[model samples]
Target chain A: MDLVDFARGPALKAAFIIFILGIVWRIVNVLLLRHKRILSEPRRSVPVALLAGLKGTGSRSWPHPEFIKRTVTGEALGYSYHIGLFIVILLFAPHIIFFGSFIGARWPALPNSVVTIFAVITITLFVAVLARRLGHPVLRHLSNFDDFFSWFVVALLLVTGLMATAHVGAPYHTILGLHILSFDLLLIWYPFGKLMHAFYIFPTRAVDGYVMTRKGAPS
Target chain B: MNTSPVDFQANLAPEEAKLGESARVAGAMRGFAREIGALSALRLDACVHCGMCADACHFYIVTEDPQYTPVLKVEPFKQVFKREAGAFAPVFRWFGLKAKITGAELARWQHLLYDSCNLCGRCSLMCPMGIDIAELIEQARRGMFEAGLAPKELYEKAAHQRRTGQPEPSDEPYRDKLLAIGRRFNVEIPLDKPRAEVLLTVPRTDIEHYPAAVAALVRVMAHLKADCTFRSDGLVAENYGYYAGGRDWQREISRRLIDQAVACQAKVLIVPECGHAYSALRWEAAELMGKSLPFKVLHITEYLAEALEAGRLRLRTAQVGATAFHDPCQLVRKGGITAAPRQLLRAMGIEPRETVRHIGYNICCGGGGGVFDIERAATLRHRVVEEKFHEIDQTGAQTFLTTCSDCRRTFDDGKKRFNWELTPGSLLELVAEHLQGG
Candidate 1:
């Protein structure tokens, strides 16, 4: 935690306020704005689709599968990019330490060797997805401004996670400061962009289940 | 007796009539935002933009319009939800592909739903993401409808539904046509029949476009001595209103049918050939009426299954040669009447080869959600059936059998558009046409 000096008392106080208020506003916005359909059953079979999608059918799926059939090459690359991103976001060393110190009591972090490998994989996977969105004619037509922002956020997340690693770059707090700043930006930016899909997925999947069962679409 | 499709604008004061028609729109930003947010939260990370859904879309393949890409259909709203995902999300809002809402932007929803999509379940067949674009279309329609924008055709249909107790029925000299048909069939075709064993509801198309499907049903009932009758009140149960995002209109249509059935004190109610009508009556009408139906009901195919299973109604003509089943979008996607129709086909001793995409995975006839407007019909209802056309061809079946009148009409159009030679017919007609009558 070498950058403890950079986390000036005023900065910690400000970041702390942003984190709390940002989260509250976000929760309120999502909760209030969401078209609520009180749950009757779990929605789309994301778990079932993900399991089936893991090996041969990754890229062609939405988050859960069904609707259209996709090519093997695309599904594989898609799963690789997303799974890598998930690990990077959820298990990044700094994120782990932050959560561990607060929740786990002991910081069980990914070894530095493993961390480097994940960063490389994540970057490659992300670039591959971005290329498809930009290069493919159909996807290109479908993509808009927020799609690029999604790419930027994903790229920033991986880079910041890598740069904020222990003794990896310009000491901890300076890099961590950028990470924190991006995060604050992320919290504020989330409600109005494609990133909001994160909160919407569960219910969307639920609706899928309801409709599929209602319509009797093949499992 | 007027079962033909009527042009609603015909009755309108030239200007209002000329307005085509649309559904209700309530400009509720909070609800719309949440709708977008829910989709974004679920799929933003989920879609890798693999382009797998491209082939799943009939319109995309038919026109090769890049905008017809399935992901593009709802992606705009997804972007909006992402911005609202967080404080930082606002920063990403500028990255959204779908534009911010406007009166002009909202106007496009009609094209998207009625023109662009046909409520088919084909994409669901291929979607690894399982993103239901059909349902999303409904949401978009609702969003726009609430905002005071609706397609002229749908608005007119809804108005007619409120007025006539049916969305597409004509007020022409159809009563004469009904009487002639009754005389020709030599059956008691009761118009406003009092009490009967069953209350039979037919799509408005039966009274005009494809009278044979209805005629075939009437003949079968006559031979079986089944005391069934037709009613001009709530004569049509096709709920393109529900498809067009008009729940109140849909409820009104349902109420009329239920009241008609109750008025006749029918021991049972039978829905013929129309898929959405079957769903609207069996599933939605009950809910809309705030009670279960007074009498039991069955789809014609389901009713046929019962008769065939009972060994009471024998098939007169055995269906020979290969056949394929095309499940209607609403019947398969909304109504849950898959195997019963197939079973009816099999009982007639027809050799049935299932389509590559069958049952719930069947593509919509592209006529659902009220895309019946002729102006934008070209763009909205283009022959997006290469997959289905191919699937049917693969079955080596010249006849495409389904349980929906809407499918019958759309498939006929699709056949002409795609140069498909296969003929679409009803499941019950097949049984009646080939039924082994003793």
Candidate 2:
């Protein structure tokens, strides 16, 4: 089969199915686990605790002031690349066209030049983050195969997408097919790897905040 | 006084090292899998490992050790969770990637789970992903305990508590010493009172080493003319089982207090100036007992703050010099009794000079989570305490005050060792000294 046919047919379909089902299965399995109830009387009401939970989901996106003072570079690089990746994946015209094909929905896309800028900034930040992870002792100790593999897959996706957009390396369909295949690989790896953080972060923050706020602490 | 941290005597008889090599790893893995409930499972799954939490940990912040990172400390737990219960467990097992925790591994993790960590919950506050790393560390301790790999000091303490209902095994008898303290203070400590508005209890350490702390509570109660009694049957506020990670014994210890409070018809059960004791009673006791407690649970600081706020207790201005208050990890950070001690200081007409990190963000005293009881942790404890000492010194206060007895003891040790000029004092003792006359 041709690269385009394989990328659009078996690979895309398999990756999409696995990605959705894997995420849904993981979420369901986790939610189905027994939750040890807080038997003690909470200092705050349930509504108040839930509100605190929601607040924590937003507030924890920013590091604490003390941490920010020490980790300004890490935090800035981390957020910049994350926001850039979000925009490049969802808001770029070609990406939106793909999204429209997949989800039957598409919003107005950013201009190609702007998307190119985001891709460059994101790629740069990703490299900086990878270098820091390799350099910093704590991060190095915390990192493992999953961390590196996830970084590698995401970086490959970005590079292939950029290559397709710029038409610099190969024929347009060939580059595009490679980009789609790279993304497919990433989606297949997503639910099993650290990429699941994209889905778990908000609920995790909410639970933490609810528990802390119920004890009368500002989470 | 011996200047060496290791020179201190062990509080309990040393436990025998009798763990075998068989199924201990399986036992630990089972415990880890069992303890990973919905919340903690999410925590295990959600760690992005940015290492920002390292900045928040007292051990990592002071020592700069990569292994001491809060996220790193939970590695063993994560490994077990991944091998047995993770989404890719089958793949991990098939590829020989499973990292089963062995007896030796558990022994090494004793330092990570016990000595180095105070389970202070500061890292929980710092995580951008909002992982409760401290709570996960506690579960790791539990898993270690299940594998018969807990520190001998903690097991001995828990054993002593289980057998004698006191924190340590004493030759002189703890009940007699407690009664002597009540007699020395010329106060009626109605032990096992049939009914009382408040059931007051103290840690065995307070009765043995700091009887003055117990006496101060009595004096404050006398001044307030409050209906309170010390039940001899459930006198100890400290929960060694909770510290040792023995869930059953922890429940047994808590049940002693719960049964006593229920039998006494206590409207309020006041835990002494011990942080973990307060946590065991106020937070974990009901959960361990599988039901809500019949009476209210309050740390001594909380009770004092509430009394002052309710206009029942009054304090004369303290004559001491400017003081800095240390917030205990369990009481202030984890337990959320932040405002009580601060408000009490304000009520005494003495404004406490605040530390650089104060209130909910206060650093651990380096001796919480039973670290003070571990002799091997002494060097690390003393070393990391300098950070708190420097922060307290920056406040320029002549005296240091804290609500938790363990924090006070830790600071006192650091003060004497470093020859720091600051005098460590307890809020309970300070209140007793300045109670309004009847």
Candidate 3:
């Protein structure tokens, strides 16, 4: 089979299956594990706790005041790239087309140039994140195989996807196939790696906020 | 360096001295495996390894040591979870990618979990992913305890609590001390008063070293005309099992009070100004006992705040000068006693000044998590205290007010050792001293 045919037919189908099933498996495996019962009477009402948790999902995105003095650069870079990744993945015109084909859903996407700019920013920030991981002593010690590997995979996916869209480094059809293949690899790796944070962060932050707020702590 | 915090080292038997490294590793792994339930499993999985927690941890912020980073402290446990409990465990095992946990490795982890971490929960607060690093460390401590890798002071303290059901160093009956202090103050200290409205418990440290503070609590109880009693059976509030990371011992220590409160038919169980004591009772006791307590659990500050809020307790509105409130890690950050002390101070007509970091974000006094009792951690503890000392200094307050007795004692130690000018005092004591009428 030609590269384009293989990429579109079997490889994409496999990626789709793996992406869906892997995420389901991870969420189930984690959610189903038995937790110790919280026996203390919650200090506040359950609704208040839930509200606090909801508040925390947005509030925890920013660092505490003490850390804010020194962490503005890191925080800005992190938020910019994460937001960029979201736009490039869901709001890009090509991605919407792909989604329309798979799930029969449609939405307007950002202009191709805008998508390309986001891709460039994401790739640059990904490189900077890796540099910080390696150069900063604390980050270096905390960085593991999962961290570096996830960074590499996502960066490669963005670069290839941008190249496919911009018609650079190869013929458009060939670059698109390469981009699909790289994304397929990322899909298979997502649920098993640190990329699972995308799904887990909000729920975890909410639960923490709920508990803290129930105790009448500042959430 | 400093003398061993306890005498456990001198009495270490030959067999105890020579650790079975493999068995200890297995034991630690078993503890980890047992404790890795859904919530902990989720927390373990959520970490992005961004090292933002380092900024939150006073241990790392003060020392600038990468190893002391909060996230790094839990790295080994995360590896264990990935290899044994993760969805891709079989793949990890097939590739032989799992690092082997050894006894010596666990021995080193003892320092990270106990000495460096105060279980302050600040890292959990800082985490964008809400990874509960302090709770994870508390669980990891259980694994260390199971492996017999806990610090000597911790083990000894736990053993002492197991044997005596109290943390008092002396053989003197605590009842006698309470009675003598009550007699000196001419306050009727009721012992084993059945069906009392409140069951007041004191830490052994309060009875021995801070009897005046204990007297203040008694005087406050009397002034409120509350039906409170101090039971000789479970009077001590400090739970060394918590400090030692021994889950069974913690449960045992907590159970003594639970059973007593149940027997006395008390309406409120008053926890002393001991940090971990408040945590052990106000948070962990109910979980350990497998039920919500029949009686309400309140730290003295929480009780005072409630009374003031309810218009039950009246203060004389004495001006104590510019005072700064030190939020005890366990009491404020962990227990949510944030506004109570502030409210109590205001009730006394003292507008307390805020430290640079106050309430939930306050820095630890550098002697929590039983680090004060670990001689090996003395130097590091001293260094971290300097960070807090600077914060206290910035407030420019002459007197430091804290609710937890452990924080109070640590500040006293820091004040004496570092020649700090601020006076260390308890919030309850301040309130008692400024009561409207006695």
Candidate 4:
């Protein structure tokens, strides 16, 4: 088989299987671990506490007012790139067709030009994120191979997908094969690396919120 | 009140010195494994290393040092989780992606977990992933404690508290101290009263250093005609066990107060101006007991605020101008007693000039999490305190007030050390000074 055929067939199937199983394994490993019982009386009702947990997921998405001045650039860059990724991955036409094939569903997509604009902006933001991580003392100290590798995996997908769409560096099929292959790598790594934060972040925030809210202090 | 500083280092036990490095590493690993419950596991898994949490740490903010980053402090503990409990642990081990934690690392992290972190929950609030970095640091402390790597001062204090139900430097019995303060102030500090409505407790700091606060509490209770009593068996509100990460000792220390409150058949248990004490009881005590506390737990400020709101206690307006209130980290951020203290201040007819980051996001007093007693941490603690002093000064307030005795002591120490103009005052004492019809 040619590059695109190999990437689209066996490689895609294997990566998809690993992605799903890896996610389930990670989640179940965490879920089945020992959980501390909350024996303390909650200040709010169960419904209110649950609501606060849901609220926490959204509330922590932005910086608190006190931290905004110092954190606005990081917050803005993070939010901007995430929004860009969502638009490019979910709202783009070809991407929709690719994702739709798996879920057996289809949805309207943004124009290719609009998707390209978002992709460009996202790539720029990703670069800025890397620069910040390397330049900032705390970020530089906290970063590990997992952090930098995770950035490279995601950024590779973005850059290759853009190249495939623009027909810039190589032939169309070759660029498309590289894009699909980059995606497969991402799928394989998603559940093992920091990218799993996509699944873990909201729930962690919600749990913390639920706990603090029960103490009458919702984070 | 004894104004003299007690050397906590003098109380250290010699047993820990016997453990070899290998044994220490094994102990810390075991402790880390034990602490990794589903909630903490989830939190550990959720960190994206966005580094926003560094801005929220008082230590990192003050020192601008990457090593002081709150999340980095727990790296060794998190490393333990990833290697032993994570889903990809086998693969990670095979590839050497995550290495085994060592005794030397735990020793280095001892300062990060105990000296720098206040367990203030500020970084927890700031984390984009909502990782609860403070909670992880607390877990890290547990691991450090198991390794016998906890600062000698904190460990000794916890051991003393676990044994005697009070921390060190008490020359007399706690009951005598209470009785003496009551007699000196001409207020009745009802001790071990049967079937009281409220069970009151004091930190050793108040009984030994700030006795006026104890007197003030009694006067206020009398003015309100509330049936509150201090039980000698559970007189202490401080929990060095909680500070030092000795869970068993923490539970034992908390159990004394819980049992006392239950025995008195009190409806309310009021924690004094001790932030960690309040946190130990109000948040973690029930969990530690494996059951809910029988009575309601309220900070002294919360109880006072409730009384003021209900018209049971009245206070005359004071002329203390441009007063700035320091929100203790545990009481405000962790306990959610933010509004109560401000409400009491308002009840006393003073509008508090808030610090730059007041309420839930307030900075720690730098000496919290028992760092004040850790002699080696003195210089770093002072640096953190300098930042707090600058924040309070910027508000241009004449009187500085706080709700935690530890915060009070920190500020008092800072005042003496730096010759700062403002001496920290307690909200409870201020309330007593303004009692309208006592």
Candidate 5:
């Protein structure tokens, strides 16, 4: 089989299976672990606690006013790249068609040119993110192989996807096959690496918020 | 005013000396394994190493030291989780991706966890992934305590408190001290009164150095005409066990107060102006007991705020010049007692000039979590105090007040060290001074 056909057939199927099962296994492992019962009285009612949990998930997304001056650059960089990734992945016409095929439904998509602009900006932000990780003393000290590798995996997909779109590297089929292969690597690594934060972030935030709110201090 | 500096450090315990190196490491690992509940597991899995938590840590902000980063301080604990209990543990072991936590690493983190962190919860608020770095650091302290690697001063105090129901400088009986203070101040400090409406507690700091605060508490109870009493068995509001990460002792200390409240049939258990004490009884006591507490737990400020709001307690306006209120970390961020103190201040016709960061986000006084008792941490603690001094000074207030005795003590230390004019005053004492009909 040709590179594109193999990439779209067996490789893509294996990646999808691994991705779904790995995510489930990790999540269940965490959920089934020992959890201490909270016997303390909650300051707020159940409904209020739940509402606070939801609010916390959203509130923590932005820095508090006191922290903005020191944290705005990192926060901005993080938000900007995440928004760019969403546009490139979900709003681009070709990418939407690819994703929509699984659900048997199609939605309107952003024009290819608009998607390209977002993709380029995202790639730049990714570079800036790496630089910040390397340059900031605290970030540099805290980072590990998992962190750098996670960045590489996602950045590889973006770079190869851009190359395939602009026809800058090899033929279209070859570049597209490389992009799909990179995605397979990401799928395999997602559960084991820090990339699992995508699934864990909101839940963690909600749980923390609920806990603090129960103490009458919602962060 | 007890202007002389008192050494807060306590002697090391004999058991700590008996722990061998390898056994200490095993103990630490066991402690870390025990704390890996579902919530902690999720928080451990959620860290993205973004480093934004550093900005929220006063230790890192002042020192600019990468080692002081909140997340890095818990690295060894997180490493223990990844190797022993994580979802990918088997895979990580096969590939040797994560290493077993070693004694050397735990020794290095000893300073990071005990000396540097205040467990203030600020870093928890700053983490984008909601990792609760401060909580993890507390868990890390659990490991350190288990390994007998906790700071000697803090560990000794915890051990002493667990044994005697009070920490160091217990030269005389606690009841004797309370009676002396009552006699000295001419305030009625009723002891062990059955069926009292309120059971009040005091911190050793107040009893030893600031006895006026104890008198103020009684006078306020008298002014409200509330049936309140102090029990010798539960007189302490300080929890060295909570500060030192000895869970069993923490539970024991909390149980003393809980049992006293129950025995007296008190409807309310009022924690004095002690931050960690309020947290221990108000939030953690029930959790440790495996059931809800029988009586309501209120910080002294909260009780005062309620009385004023209900119009049962009236205060005559006093000409206390421009004042600033320092919110204690455990009280404001962890206990949610922010508004009560402010409300009490406003009721006395004094509007507090707020620091740059006040209320729930206020900076720690650099002495919470028992860091004040460690001699090695004094320099670092002083640097943080200097930063706080700047923040409070910027408000340009003549009088400074706080609700936590530890904060008051730390500020008092800072006053002596920096030769600053303002001595930290207690809100409870301020209230007692202005009681209209007293």
Candidate 6:
């Protein structure tokens, strides 16, 4: 990896620990959110509904699209931005060098020109979404404490990542330490905030799709 | 060629989804939201939105608008339920501080109920989901009624039905009219015959709006000479209040209808293809009336079919030109009398042609839910029934035969609007036509 050595002593250790712990915590929270009492309609053409990608043959498929479009792109930017950030994190030259120092692993890096362009596009999309959360009435209505809190963490990651790349902070060790510290905090907070939807989305959609199938109705 | 304009509103505020703010009936929308959410997942898990119902609808036949497609009508409820009770509630409740019962929204809702739907419940049959869009519309009507946003026509009709037990604008000579029609038709239509073998009841709409169906029914009975009669004391037989969403109103009107049957000691009762009337009477008749009906209840088609099947009566099939049958939303969909009317027509050697979505998933006549709002959107009602016009044209049928009075009026509109030389008549009318010279 032909980049800076940004991760110092404690910074490297905390980052790995948070990443491992946060992902596990999120899984637990989402699993507990299921509604148990309202049983499915009894064997009402289950085979037919399963084939239709529906749970059964009774409801109107109205709002699922709106929910996905808005939430996945709106409050879910916590996960979306973080995901983009994650790739950037792995590709960061100094972070790669640090990971190599610790685990003796190295992957190919994006040349400097492409890294800057990718960074610009990723940051621009993040900013546009952030402005939307603040600007759009519907999105504003959907924002709560957790929504903004999660986004704030993403903002911190972006700033630190930028500062490390620009070499605007302290020495190699100090800038690396700030970047790692912010990344670790985000990892730990990811599961508890709006970003938790990322882990829940695939499972929840699968549940929706499968239930639709079981009911033999269209979702 | 495109008689059915697909540009319609029922979901996602296609010009009518705005929430109202009314402090008086303030709790209606929220309460509505809660109740809707209460039933959302249950309802969602219940329907498999297959296009099977397409063949059962009148709107699809007339307009060919996919928006009139039955399952799509319930979209707004799904969206509201998802935001409130599904997974998106925390941020969406009371988002900007608006209340229920706004004059504007009430007006829009009236359009949705009266103009777009008739709550005929025909779609319930084709529903792999059996989701019951008619019931949901009834629920929404109830919500609007609670908000005091009910259409003036709905309220007025309900009030009349509540007091007089019919959908007449007034009940001044309702009993006299029944007697007059039966006598004028030259049928031995007995009046107040006690312990009659059957209590064949037609909607007050049949009497007020289209008296020919009642006259036709009486003539058919006279020809059969079946021991049955209409109870003058049970003057009005329609139950409009049920679809307005008040269980009490539903019961109040239902009790009167049943009371007449019991009082006359009729052995059996037949409901005409008035959708909500049938729903309020036959489906919930046992529960709402609290006492079991002493007689078997059937749609007019059912009893007539039985009469024809037993060889007690016969028709010569006088209707000419490729005529098609419009299944009343309730008769085929809710009451499950799909085959009775068609079978009756076929036995008469009519060889009835069908619209695209005939029988179980019939489109509404745009007259159920007391949508008999003549003052507002009268043309829209006729416009809504245009879906049936093209279907009738497709069948090359010059006659439109249906069992419900509302459907009869709608078919008439379909004829006038399309400038087609079509005649609109009821099944009993067809029976009367067959037995005209008998």
Query: By lDDT, who's the top model here?
Result: 4
Best-to-worst order by DockQ is 4, 5, 2, 3, 1, 6
- Residue range B158-213, candidate 4, lDDT tens digits: 88888888787577888998899988999877898878999999988998899999
Query: Given candidate 1, what's the lDDT at residue B111?
Result: 53
Kindly report which residue pairs in candidate 3 clash with one another: B273-B405
Instruction: Give residue A70's error in model 2 in angstroms.
Output: 2.2
Please report the TM-score between candidate 2 and the true structure: 0.96
DockQ of each: 0.27, 0.54, 0.52, 0.57, 0.56, 0.04
Please give, for residues B1-438, the per-residue lDDT of candidate 3 as tens digits: 100111222222233346687777887888788788888888888888878888889988897888887877775677788788887777777898776676665665767887788899888888879878898998888887777777878788778787787664675788888999899877778788877989999977788778888899999998888898999888898888898878888999889888888898998999978888888888888898788889899888888888888989988876667888888888878887777888888887778888788788888998888888787788888888888899888987877888778788888888888999888888888888888866
Model 6 agreement with the true structure over A1-219: per-residue lDDT tens digits = 211233434544565676567666434432434343323222235455344434322232222332233234443554455566766767767658866877888988776566656566668767887787677533443344655777778777777677667778777556656767677678766644456544443333344444434422223
TM-score (C-alpha, index-matched) for candidate 4: 0.96
Q: Model 5: per-residue lDDT, tens digit, A34-143? A: 98888877777778777888888888888899888888989999999999999998998887888888998888899888899999999999999999999997788778
Per-model TM-score on C-alpha atoms: 0.78, 0.96, 0.95, 0.96, 0.96, 0.60
Question: Interface root mean square deviation of every model, in Å?
Answer: 8.0, 5.2, 4.3, 5.9, 6.0, 13.0
Candidate 3 C-alpha error for residue B399, in Å: 1.8
Q: Which stretches in model 2 have alpha-carbon errors above 4 Å?
A: B1-16
lDDT of 2 by residue, B298-325 (tens): 8888888888989998888887778899
**Which residue pairs clash within candidate 4?**
B273-B405
Q: After superposition, how far is residue B175 of candidate 4 from its true place, in Å?
A: 2.2
What lDDT does model 5 reach? 0.86
Q: What is the C-alpha lDDT profile of model 4 across A1-219, one tens digit per residue?
A: 999999989999999999999999999999999989988777777788789989998988877889888789888998899999999999999988888988999999999999999999999999999999889877777888889999999999999999999999999999999999999999999998999999998899899888888888748
**Best first by lDDT, ranked:** 4, 5, 2, 3, 1, 6
Candidate 3 Cα deviation (angstroms), residue A201: 1.0
For candidate 6, the docking band is incorrect
Specify the CAPRI tier of model 2: medium
User: Tell me, what's the RMSD of every candidate?
Assistant: 7.1, 3.9, 3.5, 4.3, 4.3, 11.1
